[model samples]
Target: MSLSPSTFETIVPSRYITFTFPNHHHHHHHHLRVAVLDSPSAATAAASTAAIWVPPGRESDWIFSTFSGHLQLLLTQPLSRLILIGNSPSSPQPISYNSSLHPSSPTPLQRNLAPLLSALTPKSAFLDDGEIPEVPLLVFEDEVVKSSIVEICEGPCVGEMLIENVELENDGVKEFRRRLRFKRMPNFVQSQMRICPKNVTSFENLDNMKFELDRGVLVQPYLNPMVAGISVISRFLEGRTFRPKALCLGVGGGALLGFLRVQLNFEVVGVEEDEVVLEVAKRYFGLEDDELIHLFAEDGIEYVQNLAKNLSEECRFDAIMVDLDSSDVSVGACAPPTEFVRKSVLLAVRAILHEEGVVVTNTIPSSKLLYERLICEFREVFEELYEIDAGNGENFVLIATKSKVRNALEANEGAFLNKLKSVVSGSYIDSIRKIPRTADPAF
Candidate 1:
């Protein structure tokens, strides 16, 4: 809808319409721009050349033109992949304008478009079959089309669309091409920082990912459900008489460790097996190496087994927060060596967990209506279990506690949620406060 100040103008087909046009009432401002490239090298300086922003639903809106006069770009459909040729759309004739042609002359442009018109041309590597190029496209409120062009999401990926590739004269003038790449603004994280009013939500996206990756800052990335779940865990630990000692399984971005270490001042130890995960958490998410926050790289199951065997009653932990999702082999703690998930692994965890301590876990169920086997087993182990519906999808934050929460259980859902708001921190605190009364299909 809006272009940045740095941009000056767009070349549109004569038939195309834009609000800036005199008859603004007939069309809206949302526009689609297309570019054709002769070669990678020729694509440079695309901005100076004219471009048009095509408004949807008008035939006159899409008029391919002779821009740059060097390259002709053809599109059979609305551009998922491009078939580039050196010949003009008007004629099927071959034009081989080699490197010797100067910019002022039309020879170079004609040459690039001429030879490669056929798919079988040797030089036509640009039009390779089975090549799915990640392209940039904008889909705002207004659009008139069945579905849309391939690949457009605000986050979790990045790409650029190439419009022009300049193939210089035979002597090799500086090669150039024009590409449009878009960066996703961290609006969700930034806006949260401004309004959340709590330091916990200020984890990975606390700053731009580029900056966080640069500094390797130890902050949790803002996962909506994960954030709320962590807050609920923190609230549960708030009432402990002793300083809470927390164990985090599967260091997801190391956000939980950061929160427990800085926000709750808990004696924290984070266990993660994947070397790449720890490396990325440290390098990109700013996971810190400090005395208060310790990280161990080993198989989560073996580590727990070792802890259960070695530690005495005095060494039990106040809270164990398990967030191992990616696999279903073992839900409570990463794939729980199949033998352990049956009972031993959980019993081992319970052995080291203090009598009044709590275990909080994030489990992705097989179905929203179906309860997971691990949580079902957890009910068999712990005396009191509370389930919080994350409201995102099938994410369930199950709280299994050693101490009885009669007060919380006695109070109706509304009263319990009111108590939760008072106990937890951040906007997400409210989201996880929604505790489910009954299991949809108790396994």
Candidate 2:
């Protein structure tokens, strides 16, 4: 029976027992603590699943619910962890409950259980009715309670087995023949596998193949060796003094390093925030020590800030390239807040750039909002801005230059294309060039 609104208890157990609500402002501070509380009889039964609800405005509720849900669903037999269900007023979404019975009409509680739902097994079924089943279920609504379930899965499987089940009929064989015919086209290299049937009859023309595999041919795109920090230091004073230096803010593994080194030949300095990535670059990527190359382990913005303060007036970098975060686009409702990007990071970048220097940013193609915001911020600091569209799926590079790039298309076009070719390689550069460039200022 539904409880009357007047008599219903407004207080519910908190999803996070250690931290309080809304005031826990720092996103990084709220830790999700989950505890599995099973029924006395099922104490030995693995607690596999858990559900949590978060209210609006309470930071702890959101943190616990989302993170705990991820942890619970990742465990094997997560259904056993079905321990506690708690609520908070700060939650914007309804709470999700796990039940094998009544799969369609599960009751919507005033809590956020999205984290658990995300971690739930793809095969796991849910009960539709509002009522908690005879199966173990925990329900609470508050900001200070840690909810969890018992662990069931022992360890993750080391490797996955590949199972291919192909059933080819007469029509499928005919289609395969057609594919083989297409592969015989002049443009199609015979070394590229032609579709063939499993039967011996399909090998009739195998001896006619003339092409050998070209080991020298690079099929994949060129990758930067220095993933993060990329800087170009120009020389003056008859090769004795340093002139304008350019730094690439957040390079990934020095994919851009090859281009800057070969084309500009400027003293390149790369800074990376992740220590593990830096080590990986050194070990796997061909990053070497030289007079032009310097590496540092530091955050991009912090490094720039320090450089701005310490570097001599003539020693400041003339250009800076930035590519931070894995994907250019931000997804989901719980994406990192906008303030962090607009204020903290972007502002710091502008603060460090030289007045006459340029800041080139590589961003995801689909993230229009982020691109616009970046342009707006750059416009505030620099007078000239140009963007190069590397096509869809490929990343776009924005060149925010202080020096009015004289006849950008004519002057820098050759250098830009050559740099792109050297860094990205032959076939990759061709593919990138196939994508048209748009000069829309809004982009």
Off-target runs (Cα >4 Å) in candidate 2 are 1-244, 262-264, 326-356, 365-367, 412-443
TM-score of each: 0.45, 0.41
lDDT of 2: 0.37
Each candidate: what lDDT? Answer: 0.42, 0.37
Candidate 1 stretches greater than 4 Å from native: 1-242, 326-340, 368-372, 409-443
Residues 82-189, candidate 2: write the lDDT tens digits.
333332333332122222212223344322435333333122223466333233233333221111111111112111111111112343342111100011111111
- Cα lDDT tens digits for candidate 1, 1-443: 85342222222221122222122222443222233332232322322222222222221111222221112221112221232121122222111122222232333323333321222111222335845222222211121121111112222222211111112222433222111112111101111011111324332221221111212121122333343443433434555575667788777456667756655567788887766556545643457878777888876767888998998765678778776543321121122234445578888878788776677776655444335566567767777666566554445666676655544433324432454344344554543343333553222
* Prediction-by-prediction clash tally: 38, 57
Best by TM-score: 1
